[model samples]
Target: MEFRDLNISESIMERLDEKGFTEATQIQEKAIPIVLDTELDVVGQAQTGTGKTLAFGIPIIQKIQEKIEENGRKNKKAVKAIILTPTRELALQVHDEIDSVNKGNKLRLCTVYGGQSIEKQINKLRNGVDIVIGTPGRVIDHLGRRTLKLNEIDFLVLDEADEMLNLGFIDDVEEIMSKCKEDCRKLLFSATLPKSIMELVELHMGEYETIRVKSKALTTELTEQIYYEVKEHDKFELLRRIIDKEPGFYGLVFCKTKADVDQLMRRLNDENYSSEALHGDMNQKQRELALSRFKSHKIDIMIATDVAARGIDINELTHVINYDIPQNPEAYVHRIGRTGRAGNKGTAITFVEPREFRRFKYIMKISKSDAKKEKIPDVTEIVELTKTNIIGKLKQLIQTENSEDSEDLENYEFENLEIVDELIELADSKVIIDKLISQLFKEELNRKSYGRIGDYGSRKGNDGRDSRRDGRNDRDRRDGRRNDRDRNDRNDRNDRDRRDNRRRNNDGGSRLFVALGSMDNMDTRRLLRKVLEKSDVSKDNISEVNVYRNFSFISADEKTAKQIVDSFRSERRNGKPLIEYAKR
Candidate 1:
């Protein structure tokens, strides 16, 4: 259905057409008429990328404009509508998309979120806005400051209410709603209708109309789904290898937590891969810069957590890799929906650990999506593909003899044409050509240039698929291997036995005691990573890390040591302080 069919005015229809929104989606086609004609509250259930913003945005703008014309410019800057989102990214996205539809009108809009100056936001609010798009926390802050008055708002929208519930913002949402006009027409939109969402509807939208539309991406037909069963330790190796296998891979990779995103992004950048991290910890400027780089193709891969990835719409994404499989099938569907958008073909790849195979199967069954087992390609195979793909992209560039390509590539190889002819005559023709080609792609053509990926033939069964077992059993095996490694390094343990002498001498370094050890999930690598992340310490400046059953110690420069000590006052993991210096 088209916007014109929904009784939208010619002016608004012209704006929609200019933005290429010719056809109305299921929710838009159904909900637009109700909002434009009726006074009942609405609850719209649709997929993430299913044009939910426009569904409510169009009617809101039209209704506001109609009110303005009917009332004769009396409430020019009076707040009439408020749209609340779960995150800052989603807030900005809604504001931008709706602003496009509200263009050429006298309507005013402002977006408020944390990580920006509150004073600036206050100034914007005082300037008399018609519509406001913001996150819950910021909206509550504005209300407390007495800068934003919602009592005059005629419409209130809770976008992504399920996400708001997951983020523990439902309480805040209720508080904001309580402060709104009692008779305001409320609209609730979410991808899912959890019990909490229904509770919200019962409390606020007593007489609401509902619209639920199932999008085709839920089945994932346009995406080729594949999974490789690998151990947790070998997942990074497989990830790197798969990345090398596809030369044109440009997409997002999902991690389960922010720390995982940071660690994986660090490893990828260390290996010279174009990548960046997006998570809740990053400031708004940093997140915007990372997103800008990803969209402009300056980086080929973006590592993000699920919460941080909400409201991102990149229609040309080629792939979506699940580095950590989501816990539920709905979350899985949401992650894979990033690709196969705008009718483009895409691929969804997942790495299932030994213990996750059954859970993954359950997800597949619940979502009714088909996934095939794929093996990690060999290094030699990746090298061959790299050469072939690179040649395919640059073949026309090297065709110097062709004079038909717009001034012949605009003089790309024109200067080298005479030299090529001279060189061909100076040596055997085929020998010269082969030597030139090999030298041209020296790094890409070399098998050793690609790093080593582990061999897992022993882990595969007779059927050429992974031999699955409990991850706890695999951990036991790894523990046994660690014990052997410790036994082999007894000489290093003997060095630690001379602890008193080193503590007194200090070896021109400071030895600090850590409050955690093996029992608290402490280890040399993990402790080092935590310390370096919290402070300005260089890895080379630290040494002599020793972990015991209940405590640990490490040596670093006095500056790094003091920074680490000060950082722990606020730094924590899983709500527990990670480090504390000895009382001396």
Candidate 2:
């Protein structure tokens, strides 16, 4: 439905036009008219792209004017509306959207969230604001401090209500609601209405209108959703490799925090990838500049946080990489929503460590995301991806005949080959094209790229380099002592053999000493077999398997021996008996 169909104020319609919004989404089409009709409660259930913001925002903005008219400036301390969001990033995002649609109009707006100083927010509140968009925690803090007087508030909006519950802010939300005037209008918007949220609707919202939109909570039909299980220490390097391998991937890499986004952006730039970052800290112009670079095909990738990407409405976004899986399932839908837009196919790649997969799977189940486990791209795949991207770019440049640069390209082509002989020149040009394509990728190669094979960061916590060095030194000392003892024993044996005029022979195989005991209730045989399978050790290489009541022992090659010992010591895998190398 068109925006004209809604009975909103003329000013709001002008602002919507300015923002390039003509048709209203399903939620907006229904919720707007309902909200505008009465100052009653509303419960909107829709996915991220369904435009729930304007549905609630327009009504709240309209109600503020009515409130100001009814109460007058004499009692301006009373805010007309309050929007409670799940995160500071989301609060800021909602505020921006409201601000954009309500520009060139007389409406005061302030956003309060954590991370930023409360002093500034309190000062803004003191200056007198009509609307507040805030996180539950900060909003509660303000309500307790009596800095934000919601007693006179006419409207209340809970954006992404399910997320507020997931973040454990429901109690805080209830507390804030208690502070609001009992007669205030309430609107609860969420991707999926959970039972708790439904209970909230029943208790708090009175005679609410329910609007539901038909769309997959998470649709992977047109997109491929995959994740790589990497250790925390290795994520950065692994992400670096993925970026290098995925060619022409116009995508957004999502990080949990703004700090992470900034650091990853810096690292990507250092690795020579044309990437930029978007975050809350950036000013309006900076945000616009970064987005403009992305939209114009100047920037290949955009690294952003979920909050920073809230106001982003870029088309041609093909991939959404979740560098960190969201704690809230609703956020997972929103992040992936940036892609698979306008009927275009998209890919969402998440980096899930082993422990995180449990939570990841839970999100998938709730969001109904058709995410599948995928093999991480090897180095060869990355190289091939890079080559393919470069070749595509070159082919496009050749096909698109530019009047100004056509002669230059044509002359260069002639100089490089025998154009006088048609077939030979064609064949030569093809060969040169292939050679140049390889060279292009070679130039763009990330020299710092390395697949981190089982990181040691967890073991070297507290003190980074010092701990690693100390561990290595202690291992070296232990090995050195064992070697010395072996030398002395062999020397004595040789002397004995020489004296007896007989050949020396040895029959005992390599021994593996385990640290686990009967006290731990470990099944020795099962543990031994699992160890061999996990390490991919050959059965022939494994000699005598000795099972002790306390600690079991296995015999294997020196390489397999060290791997088994390290795997047990790492404590990463579950269901494994905690057994370290007692002796070898």
Q: Which candidate has the top score in lDDT?
A: 1
Per-residue alpha-carbon lDDT of model 2 for 229-313, expressed as tens digits?
6656567767767766666578999998889999779766654678999998999999999999988989888999877887788
Model 1 misplaced stretches (Cα beyond 4 Å): 72-77, 214-219, 226-243, 247-346, 349-381, 384-438, 445-584
Clashes of each: 0, 3
Per-residue error (Å), model 2, residue 496: 60
**Global Cα lDDT for candidate 1:** 0.76
Residue range 408-429, candidate 1, lDDT tens digits: 4554545678887799789998
- Candidate 2, residue 154: how far the Cα is off, in Å: 1.0
The candidate 1 region of ten consecutive residues with least summed lDDT is 474-483
The pairs that clash in candidate 2 are 245-382, 517-550, 518-550
Candidate 2 to truth, TM = 0.61
Per-residue lDDT of 154 in model 2: 80
